[model samples]
Each structure stands twice: as structure tokens, then as C-alpha cells.
Target: MNTDSTRRWLALGALAVAMLTIGLDMTVLTVALPTLAVDLNANNGALQWFSTSYTLALAAVMLPAGALGDRYGRKKILLAALVLFGVASLACAFAATAGQLIAARVVLGVAAAAMMPLSLAVLPVLFASPVERARATNIWITSTALGLPLGPILGGWLIDNFWWGSVFLINVPMVVLGAVAVAGLVPESRNPDLRPLDLPGTVLSVVGMLGVTYGFIRLGDEGWGNGLGWGALIAGAIVLMLFLGWQRRTAFPLIDLGLFASRGFRWGAVFAVLITFGLFGLFFTVPQYYQAVLGTDALGSGLRLLPMIGGLLVGSRLGDRLLPKLGARLMVAAGLVALALGLGLGALTSIGTEYWFTAVWIGLVGAGMGLGLPVSMAVAMDDLEVARAGMGSALLQALRQAAGTIAVALLGTVLATVYRSELGDLNVDPINDSVNSGVAVAKSTGEAGMLEHVQSAFVSGMGAMLWVCAAISAVAVALALWVLPRRSAAVGADEAVPAVFADVDAPESTHVG
Candidate 1:
């Protein structure tokens, strides 16, 4: 309530805005896809690439980015990354072709790889106590969560009222002012004993991540039969194996694999992965079912998700308060149960199913994720040395994001497969030709009945993915219960905000004491 407190909250607010930009980019781009395809004369594969490329690049560099931030400084890297992100956004606004947009977005993703987690890692240090750190994290999670769903509403408004470029242009002022606010208000911290960048480790990890992502995406298109998909995946695994080997031997590893030796840290990563799988996967699928099967417009489709959104807002707020009271075990377990129940319930939806029927189920899914995300994340870094927090959170976040993308690709592919199988006499070429135009062609070809079947397949695939999410959340819960010390022993571990990431991977650069 005093001036010092006011300044700290103001700093958190600025960081929240930074977090919002990252989530908004993900959702907003989806909303603008139709416009993008038409204006740029893009095909379905190209449109998919728009998102896929950014995701791929983001995942590939996350570990390295955090370390880079740490070795240099979280604040310096963060500000620099923000500047580049804004510039890239401006470029994306004027992107003349699909390739150009993809290029700039890839850059934006690189910047986001740095920005998103750093915001979380950085802001908590501003608050003095463990409770204050928890409260700050609660705010960060809520803002980031809201940004994803809010994107459609905001992007739709921009696209309808102005131009597609307006979406990217919106980031300009946020980035400019965000840089200024953070520089002035945020204290810089770094590992006092920072090491030089681990060049070989960085190269290996990036290649491995890029390969894995490309393989999954290619498989979505060409099936596992495609040699490229299988080859990239195999080679990617090998590269990643090599990267892990390097991590173990190197004096300065990109990620300290040793950290996972703690049961709590390992499970925390699992919890992160599970939440993204269920949350973003459902977020990706439901809107299509709404528009394609139920006949809602884009705006209506976006709005239909409000129940889940409402639940997210409510549950994230409540989860923060409950973590201290319940400890990690009960909270994460309960959240997983809610998530599985919601997804399993959603699997029952069929051709032309009622919205409200699924609404309750979807609401459960959102609420459950809200519970898992914050605590699981906080738990991972709870007991870590301050120097290691950046790498830990970045590692956790990258894994979570990868899980979401894989679910999207896997579920999307599964739906595509099932739709095709049940597609008896539908125009396969049209659907395969372009994601954006497929529905129009399907309608014209007397395949309207098939729409429901495809929708059902997608919902079914989502349920399957949810089962995977449940398993992972359970793993995370186990880690939290076992790895973290007993609740009565010490809660200070929970209170210590992960500055390694803020300070993004490598800790001292961004945070200062």
C-alpha cells in the first residue's frame, strides 16, 4: 500500500503486459489466419506453417535463450529481446507474403522464448516475502492465461475493424513502453559467477528441437510413412541424446540435468507439460467444431469459450490462495481429476451436440488446468538454488509448450485420419488442399453430413489427448508430493521465486540484489 509496494506492483504490471504479448501472439495469429491466407494467397500448409514455424523456433531456442540471458544479464537480454520482438511485430504487420510473415514470426518466437519466462522469473524478486512471491506469480499466471483466450476477441475486433497488420502493429507500443518501464523499475540480477555460453551444447539442442518439431508437423501432413518425418524424428532424438550427454560432461551445461534428480523438480515439469497439453489442445480444437459443425461465426465461436475462460479466471485466483493451505500434493491431484473428468465428458459430444452440455465439461477442464499450472510451475523452482532458477523454468515451459504443439499435431492428424476414414465419398482433395477453404468446399460437395463426423473425431481425439495429460499431471503430482520436502519442514523453498529465468536462464544478468 505504500510507495515501495506501489512501485513493486507497477513493475509486476509491466511484466504482466510482457506476458500478455507472448500469449496474445499465439491466439491472435489463429484468428487472423483466414485473412492471412486470402491476402497472401496462401494454402493450408502455409497457414499451418505460420504457427508451426514460430512454435518450432521457440521450442528450439528456449534453453539456450535463458542461458544466454543469464550469461549476459536477464534485464539486458530481456530489453534487447523486447526491442527485437517489437521490430519483428512491425515487420509482421507489413509482411507481404507467407514466407515473410513466417520469418518475422520465427524471430518473434525467439524473442518470446526469452521474454515470457523471464517476466515470471524476474517480477517475484521485487516482492520481499514468500507470500508476496506467490501472489505475484498468481497475477502472472492469470494474465498469461487470459491473453490466450482474449486473443480471439481482440484479434477479431482488429481484423473486422481494420487490417490484419493491425494485429502486429498493436505490439509496437507495448514493446516500446515495456522496455522503458522494466529498465527503470526492474532491478537487475545475474549469477555472480556466470560462465561463458556453452556453444556446442547450444548447437546440439537447437538442432534436436527443430528436428523433433519438424518431424511431428510433417507427420501431421504426410503420415508417419513419410520418410522425412521418421528420419527427422529419429535423428532429432539422437541429437538430443548427444545434447544430454554434453550437458552431463560440460562444466557449464545448458541445463543442469542433475536438477531433475529431485522428485519435486521432475514432477513440476510434468505438471507444466500436462496443463499445456489439455489446455491449448482443447483451445485449438473446440473453435473449429463450433464453427464447422454448429454453424457459429468466428466471433460466436470465440465467445462460446467463455465458460472455460470464466473458470480459468476463478480457479487460478483460488488455486493461488489454496497452495499455501493445501500444500502441493492435494492441490495438483485434485486438479488432474477435474481435468480428466472434463475431457472424458467432452468425448461424449457428437454431431450437433448441445453447447451447454459440453460447457460444463469444458469449464471443469479450464478450472483444473488453472489449478495445475501455477503450483506445478512454482513447485519446480521452489527449492532450486537462485542461480539455477532461469534454466529450470525455461526447461519446464519449453517442455509444456512442446507438449501442447505435439497434441495439436497428433490430435489434428488423428482427426484428419478419422475424418478421412469416415469421409466415405467426400472430396478428400479439397480438405487436404487447404485448411481455411476446406469447409466451404465440403459444404458445396454435399458432404455437410460429414462435418459432424469430423467434428466428433476431433472431440474424440481431444479426449485421448486428455488421458495423456492426466497421466502426466499425475506424474507431476507425485513429484510434488515426494520430491519437495515435507510441508512443515520448510515452505521457504516455495517462496523463493525462480530468478534463474528472470535473472531468464542464466540468473544474475537480469536480477540484482
Candidate 2:
């Protein structure tokens, strides 16, 4: 209705575009992995690095990125990040070897680390009204959700028609447009009372996260008995314990440990992490099932996942309305119930099951994620002072990423271990490598039995993995019910917005320095 209102919504669009790039990057590379393996002459190890490098780099810098935005300016950092992301995307597109691509991905991850938190951090400053913030957040969630399915569909089409590099190159025009829009629309905001950077705390947090993340990743790659993996896990756990202790003692800590005192922040964070744990784990397994067992091409598989995106949009809309009425507790609890039911259905899927059965479960899980994730995320941010918005958002996202990484690692290990054990004494070297490798081998040798065996083994592993996901969702439901706050308490913690034309006012700039 008003000019200022229009600008803020437009600003949110720019932020959403930036967020969309990050989400697209997450899944876009996945479909190209096989192409990369051949074109780059990559071994299994190097192939894993292409993905892991990005994730590790992103995790390592998140804590610091948030502080940097708070100390300087959120908009300034976001603009710079957009430029860096575009440059990194170009590098990724032109990479000639696995090593070069991995290096490029690391840069892309660091740029994304800065954008992700600051994008959400600006929300508190943008839409001050609680009702408006909820609706804005739903749109923000949808933009990110839209990118997930787009990656597979778009990446599949690019890989099918063009080269593998085109997937990364496509990000260039979008990022450039996003940077221009953000520069013109988004306001500069930072914490005037923010303290100097805590150098020691920063180092500790980085070390702790990197060590833990690497250990889990190694566990997936090399298995449980690897000495290096065990050593990394032990060392990471010890370092993280020390980091927690330091956080408690530090004068100007990297993150305020006191924020955990609020039940809303604490449990909301846990539920958020659980949501990613299931979602990423499912994504990790389901695509391969489509390609390997169902004998579908990349494009077909990507198109098949469209139903989940539809469910996510519908669920997000429901969350925006239900969160205000049901409170965080009941709404998230219901979502987790839906998630568990969906996972349970997925666990029952066999090798020859129809696509519609899978779609029903996938849609349910997506809907659950749509409902649960935003409510929990908003609850985590609701009580945060505007000054700590960056750090709070960073902490929430960092934790979720960590959870997703661990979920993928653990669930992948489960699938691999069960598949291998079930296909014991196969004596088929190619078959033991992976489902894709086994299928290729089977077709080359013209052995129908081999394909059947591989399919059966993989289905067993998938079923077991989905059951584990269902169990986790069940636990999340109980935690949501037990720990989430009532409507009155959650509303009491909701931050208030000053008038639209207050002293700190404008269409272009809103918050004070």
C-alpha cells in the first residue's frame, strides 16, 4: 500500500535471489558427479572431495562470517559475497581437473557462508511487524525451496544438452543480477555496540567444526575402522568440548552462550537440525535409487522430485498461518508426525514399487520440512536482539549444516554397509563398488542375475536407511512436544518493530548505525 513497504518487499526479493543461488549450488553439482568423474579423471576419493570441500569450507567460516557482517555491515558483506560467488562459479565452470574444481568449490562455499546468514539476519531489520515478518519468512523459505528442485531439473537438462560445466556457468548471470539488485535496494545495517572480534574463540570454533566435520566425512568414505577417522573423531570431540568451555569463560565470546538459556532457541535449534538430518539423508539416497534401480535418466529423476517441491510450497503456506495459532510446539509436533509417517512409508518401498508410492511419502516429508523448518528457525531468531541477529542466524544454520553432513555420512555408511553385507562373496569387484558401478558392470557383462542382486541389495540398504530416518523423526516429535514454548511465551519473545517512519527510517535504509 505504501512506498516504504514496497521497497522492503523488493529488498526481500534480492535477498531471496541470493539465497536461491546457494540452494541451487547445493544440489546442482550432484547430478554432474558422474560426468565429472570421467571428464576430470577422478577417483572415488577425488569425487568425494569435489562435494566435501565446499561443505567443509562453508562450515569452517560460518562463525566468523556472521561476526564480520555484524562488525562491518550486513549489506556490504552480502554484496561482496555475491561478486565472489559469481567469480567462484566461473572458476568452477572452467575447472580442468578434479583438484582445480575442488579448489573453486571451496571459494564458492566461503562466499555462500557469508550470504546465507546475512540474508536472514536482515529480516529482523526489514519487516518489523510480526505478522509481516512471518509472511516474509515464508516467502524466503519458498525461494530457497524452489531452488532445490530447479537444481536437478536444470542441471540435468544442462548436462544432457550442454557440457557438465554449464551447470556452474548458469549461476553467473543470476548472481550478477542479484548483486545489482541488492546493492540498489538492501540497506546497510550493523551492530553499533558490537565488540571487537574474539580471535581465540574464532580459531577454536573453526578448528572444532572442521575437525568434527572431517571426521564424519572420513567415516563415510573410509569406514569405521580407519585409524585416521577414529583419531579425527576423538580429537574433534575433545576440541569442541574445549571450545564450549572457552565460550563460557570468554568476555566477548564469538557467540553468546547465554542465548541457550531460552528454551525456544535451544529446542528450536535441535528441531531444525533434525529436520535437515532427515531431508539431506533422504536426498542422498533417493536420487541413486531412481537412477540405479528404476533405470531412469538424470532428467527423469529430477522431474520426479517435483512433487516434493509442490508439497514444500503448500506446507510453507500452512506454517505461516498455523504458527500464529498453534504455537511452535503443536505446529512443529504435527509436522514431525507427518515426517515420521512419510519415512515409515518410504521404508516399506521395495525394488519394483510404483513411482506414485514414493511420491506420496516424499511429498509428506517435504510438507513436514516446510512446516517444521520455518517455525523452528523463526523461534530461534525471535528472541535475538537485533545486534546479535547475524551471529544467531549463523549459529542456527551452522548447526543445521553440521547435522545434514553427519546425516549424509551416517546414512550413506548404513546403505553401503548393508548392501555389501547382503551381497557377500559376490566376487564382483565392480559390483562391490556402488550401485551405479554394479549396474554398469551387469549391463556390460549381460548378466541379468547380477543386476537383480545389486538391485535387491541396494533396496535392502535403502529400506534400512529410511527406517533410521523415521526413527529420528519420531524422536524429533517427542522433543518438539516436550521442549517447545506455548503461544503466549513465544509471542512475548517476539521482537517489536518501531513505526515505519521512525527516526531510523527510509525506503532504502531502515536500521541505525
Q: Each candidate: RMSD to true structure?
A: 4.7, 5.5
Local accuracy of candidate 1 as per-residue lDDT tens digits, 87-187: 99999999999889989988998888888656655754687687787788767755665566777778777877789899889888988878888888887
The candidate that achieves the highest TM-score relative to the unseen native structure: 2
Per-candidate TM-scores read: 0.82, 0.85
Give the winner by lDDT: 2
Model 2 alpha-carbon drift over 4 Å, by segment: 1-16, 34-52, 73-76, 96-99, 119-142, 180-190, 320-326, 383-390, 427-430, 486-513
User: What is the C-alpha local distance difference test score of each model?
Assistant: 0.67, 0.74
Global CA lDDT of candidate 1, please?
0.67
lDDT per residue (tens digit) for residues 135-183 in model 2: 7766666576566778889988898889999999988988888898888
Point out where model 1 deviates above 4 Å.
Answer: 1-15, 33-48, 117-146, 180-191, 317-327, 383-387, 433-436, 444-513
RMSD of 1: 4.7
